[model samples]
Target: MENSPEIATDAASLRPAGVSAVALSRLASATGGQLLHVPQNADPDEIAISGVSIDSRSVRSGDLYAALPGARFHGADFTRSAREAGAAAVLTDPAGAQILGSDPGLPVVVTPDPRSQVGAIARAVYDSQPEDGSGLSLFAVTGTNGKTTTTYFTNSILRALGETTGLIGTIEILAGGQRIPSRLTTPEAPTVHALLSVMRESGMTAASMEVSSHAIAFHRVDGIRYDVAGFTNLTQDHLDLHGTMEAYFGVKAQLFTPERTQRAVIAVADDDDEWGIRMARHARAQLGAENVDVFAMRGGVVADREEDPDRRGADWTLRSMSRRGIGHRFELVHRDGRSLRVSTGLPGEFNVANAALAALMILASGVELETLQRVLDDDDPLTTDVPGRMQLIGTEPTAVVDFAHNPDALARALAAVDPPDGDGRVILVFGATGDRDRTKRPLMGEIAAREADVVIISDDDPHGEDPAAIREEVAAGARSLVEAGTARAVEVYEISPRAVAIRSAVQMAGPQDSVIVAGRGHETVQEIAGVDHPLDDRAELRAALDEMQEGRWERR
Candidate 1:
């Protein structure tokens, strides 16, 4: 986009996909909202809301436009555009009502909490009631990280089992068989219900979705019950929004409750991360011991991958792991005598953890273990290339691309990228996203310094924040270790342009070293100021790696 009013922002892409034409009175009854400026010719109950849209530009005929209040502008400010776009009704709060000032003919639904009510109203409009084994078995996966990978794994497994599976997550939304890249980690309430409605209409048998902290905090998944809600460990992330780790975890914890989910799958691989343990206990209490299962990896990740064979209380165990080319194969033994032999092409230890959680969640959904194992045994298993999650683009210096933005994710990515020789270095090129969770910047710096041999701090998405300042804050955190002589052996670089950071990291790396380009995984655009600049980390990393290879050949 060109940073203009005419340019549809990436957010517009998150607008609900299907049309929702429910009676106006149904929406009012669903939200306990009162209709304002009711069209007299049309019965308040008879006026249909054909669709729901938060963005005025995308409003279609018979659509109900939600004028939600935000920190900057009340959604009502665009009421004129919504009306011009043929909106049937407007949903807004009292403040928005005041802004309208008796717009005589335009139908409106006045409610105090439009944001929270959006999902409920949307569910009513789209007729997307996910009853027991309705159109698809819904799976909700949430955590600070690994959400995307787990969703991918679960969806791939479902498809391999001959089920038409839909997937909604950070990477994209898959309905029927169509793939739509997502604008949010989780779409807004109306969009989510609308998408589910689409899948239900398409006769999808199962769908796996990534539920983010923002989704839970904002009730984005309201009115929809999940068959399985998977938690992939909690970590220090999004502190800027939640203010504390406790608050953040509280939001994630809601997804595991009986009211929100029917079953739960928690990864207990890293016993050190106690959050999973707590979530497991909570799920057992809420969903029953039979409804909950824990997975600990003893097999897939290489030597760096740790497994507690004597791990207590785990229902499923990856008993052993061995490498086959770039992939790892493991045997997953259930609490019962049943077992599943699994394999994946991805090399990261975190992928192993994600796959384990995905596998257990699939099992919880009632898929036969033998059938799932047959799917993993195919020449291609779980589709293993998850966009930009630890994707290997080169061999000489072992270039890898990952989406590790937060401190916890960054630390895990560093620890998982072990080179062949023990002395080989892990070179990381990553930066914290600007205008989001500033609290994580220093924490990320400290963690990177502790885990990585070389750190190149650069731009992720400046998004109106000063790019240089963001780098300085992260660099300052890492520099603290150097000043104390704790991380003097760790080399650090402060690069302005991210392209330079990626190339510099690759150039400085030798054959024994691994170069990891973190952040902005699978994203083709980088937001700076108000415009999105075309950029892909995977593409940049590949170009850099190729350039280095050509240079080496010329030198010979």
Candidate 2:
């Protein structure tokens, strides 16, 4: 017999593929969440899952319906719908527990706080409990603008270097060949761990994920221990959830806490980066964390003589960088006195920074600089394209779809595709999100008016926010430029329907011109008045451009 140490695995210890009813009870009990329903002597190894679903419409027969409570609607209200669709069981909060009485025949579990505990419960019930600390390396990137792109870049580079990888971001989750559509910026804790386990089983050695401030604040990433935590940058976003900018930053800062993380990769060019470094330093002193790495894109960069001067910064300095046609070339110099010149087919300086951040993160993972560089230069950066982050739609008169909803990101996008050195205008189409950071509306308008030649204020998921009011505020800010004589008279068109605005903008764009369909990037659905309408900016932009081209063809 082979002398192998017996790995203690139980019903609860079994992986998600082997989960049972007893597993669910223990998961709820561990989190101080109460379980209302229990089958006597239920087996804990009978897996009762295909996956978990929060929406009734998507709930399948084996799924656990997470009946969460929201301000606008109670998830319990959808319980009947979930059951009708064949959900195995319904999970709800203490308040929603009463809804279970309405349907006694349903297999219902009452949780103390469904939203907070669901992730933990999900992790406990599905995953083979992580043995203290062990298994695949996990890297999480968080920021307002670069989260999705940076994660995608890292995933691509890792895969290029021959490591099977898993990625979760704004675009999709790449687990093996499965491309799961992402429903949250950072999946709730249970789904996160479950996905990680699946990745590990699918032969992934590493996983790159995007973490959002909302996820942190809501304790969405509660149970998993991240090997490397990256801070891309921070700016005004999701203010409705955090209430203030300081609060938003506070939530983002929690990811770096000693209790939660081990290593960190922070971007120094952002003001939030300076604060993050400070927070990391404090956490290090308090918790004795060993690996804290920093990379600066510009401005705050500290170059050393030992490092190549042609580089942007000494510590993983970006150097010899140039844009050739539709691609970029740059050098990454590590602290150990090694440099590798890399080229990416992706355009824009922002992408260069994103690539640099990925390099630093890969370096932090103990991969050889040259090997990772070869992967980035040869395989990853060339083919990888983040869904909504600076995703260009057409040529001649170019149209791009970007998720630049805030002022800072909008400013960066404006700086990125600077009008192609021509007499044509940079037209913008965007609208502020409803019930979110109302303060940023005028700022977004101001940036658009200041940066672009023509501004088209349009709808961007005004979700109960008066579309006209949102557009009016943005237009008001844009019109301020003309009123102050700071700009060469800008046109502010109030196009309520987003598609109409996109069509209008694309038609107006000439050969030397560029049209930015801003705000909604990779999002496939647009939420309006509590309903998600199917929408894809990239597809719409493409169709609109094709229409414009067809019209031009007819005119000719």
Candidate 3:
């Protein structure tokens, strides 16, 4: 809220995504940028911006193009293209100025750290703030996994309470009723402020978001203030970006700081990982005990599992669960001894934890327990189907689609959907994403082999990396278990063209067998050689099942 500003303007000045026209001098002053050049014919006060975009191709007329540094090349390399696309001004660092080639007569706001400062500039440009004079209640969830599910749960439940809510996560953005695909777990700072501005303009007063470790470290959420910040358990993920486990924990811990958040809702179900414990300690040190609440898994056989669910047995707990057809009716007991009973459409015990954590966030927001009980007591109840998180596709073979992309997620998902003794077989069909932390590839293989009777390794977002090579690494991990005789009945298969692998898994499923299609759950595209080929795991799985029902399904 530091750089937030107020300005009086009419409808003509309002631009796309709710960005308002602002003086060039004002943007420069807010960003502390050195104004390199101004057009000879244009006045600094008269120059106006409609929006901000990092991608050159998406740049629009009267937009401010932010050209930052990238892994392969300087984004400023596209300055001419942005200019051609009608960008009114450019924001970049000194390095980008060099790439922009001395003047060219366009106004350039040059800052030493553009990425860290853009969110503040964006907030000023768009006049993004709660219109009701009350600060917008922003909620966020962070962890290696379950973040998307938690965000959806939090947002959906809030909506059920008759609140206009915005949602941002790894999957998509729901600005009121408008939905858009997510490009990052947490978008760039400017994008965050812009989207918030859009939401406010669309009559939304609150928002739920997923904050990623990379986003925290990169300052993607630099200027936003969250009302409630929740934590799912940390695990082995994004090691490719953060480099080490400790470093990953360190960045994730930043979200709990009092500067970024007000009230905290942390899931402390994981008895193994101490990061959540350390996070609670850190948050209490800054925000004090009253503002921080740590909730952990208290009942159900879920807590006894090896997966660290990050429950601390502290302020609140979930007890007495009665599951009903891929759903559960549970009792949420708070530290103050008050309890609320609720039901969720979400399957898997881990989702019960997600819903409980979300309910605690609602409680922290001052919703009455009786009100929540009434909502849950409704004939329909409040439940959300998070795309690809235990999404069931068939009843005959009992197939499910999930976004369990990593080892811990794969393990927990397998455990959640595992069949009982003499019940049936658990067949897993999955692959690892390319250009990610290679360490998890083999670990994913290990989990599938150990948990499922049939393991089919395939492709997932190969990117620019070789598809065959990525498959081999995962297969090696699963095959290692077979060589060790630990997963004796485990049968492994290596397949390509993901559709083929999915079809094979479907055909192999017998009655009572559960076929899980992991990774790339809600994703609609598969990356290969820098191109996104059309593909959706859910769509493909459904197609495979439909074909099987028609007695025309075949696999090679």
Please report, in order, the local distance difference test score of every candidate based on alpha carbons: 0.79, 0.71, 0.79
Task: Tell me how many clashing residue pairs each candidate has.
Answer: 4, 4, 10
What TM-score should be assigned to candidate 3? 0.89
lDDT, candidate 2, 1-556, per-residue tens: 0112223211111134444433444444465655555455554234355456666776666667888888798898888888788877777886777766754445566756777766666665456236654457788888777888888888777777777777777666665446666667776665666667766666668888888887887777877667778777777778778887777777777877665667777666633355544544544453343466656555444544232222223255566778767668877665666887766666677777777777778777788766776676566454477788888788777778899889988988877766656566788888889988888999888888888888888999989977788889888888888789786426777886898888788877787887888888989888888889998889888988787777753311
* Residue-wise C-alpha lDDT for candidate 1, range 1-556, written one tens digit per residue: 1011132234334333455467888778788888879856778777878778888887877888999988899899999998988998899999999998886358888888988888887777776764444646899899888999889888778777877777788887776445677888888877787778777777677888899999888878887888888988788888878999888877888888888888888886545557776776677777777788877664332132223322336777776788756667778787666888777778766777788888888888887777777777873445456898988888768888999998878887887786756768888888989889888899888887887888889999989899999999999899898778887236888986898888888888888788899888899999999999889999998988888878853311
Query: What is the lDDT, from 0 to 100, of the residue 531 in candidate 1?
Result: 96
**What alpha-carbon RMSD in Å does predicted model 2 have with respect to the real structure?**
7.1
Query: What C-alpha lDDT, on a 0 to 100 scale, does residue 515 get in candidate 2?
Result: 84
Ranking of all predicted structures according to lDDT, beginning with the best and ending with the worst: 3, 1, 2
Off by over 4 Å in 2: 1-16, 20-29, 32-69, 72-115, 132-134, 270-289, 300-315, 334-336, 380-383, 420-423, 530-534, 550-556
Compare candidates 2 and 3 on lDDT and give the better one.
3
- lDDT of model number 3: 0.79
Ten-residue region with minimum lDDT total, candidate 2? 1-10
What's model 2's overall lDDT? 0.71
* Top-TM-score candidate index: 1
After superposition, the stretches of candidate 1 with alpha carbons farther than 4 Å from their true spots are 1-20, 130-133, 297-312, 552-556
Candidate 3 residue-pair clash tally: 10
TM-score for each model: 0.90, 0.81, 0.89
**What is the TM-score of candidate 1?**
0.90
Candidate 3 lowest-lDDT run of ten: 1-10
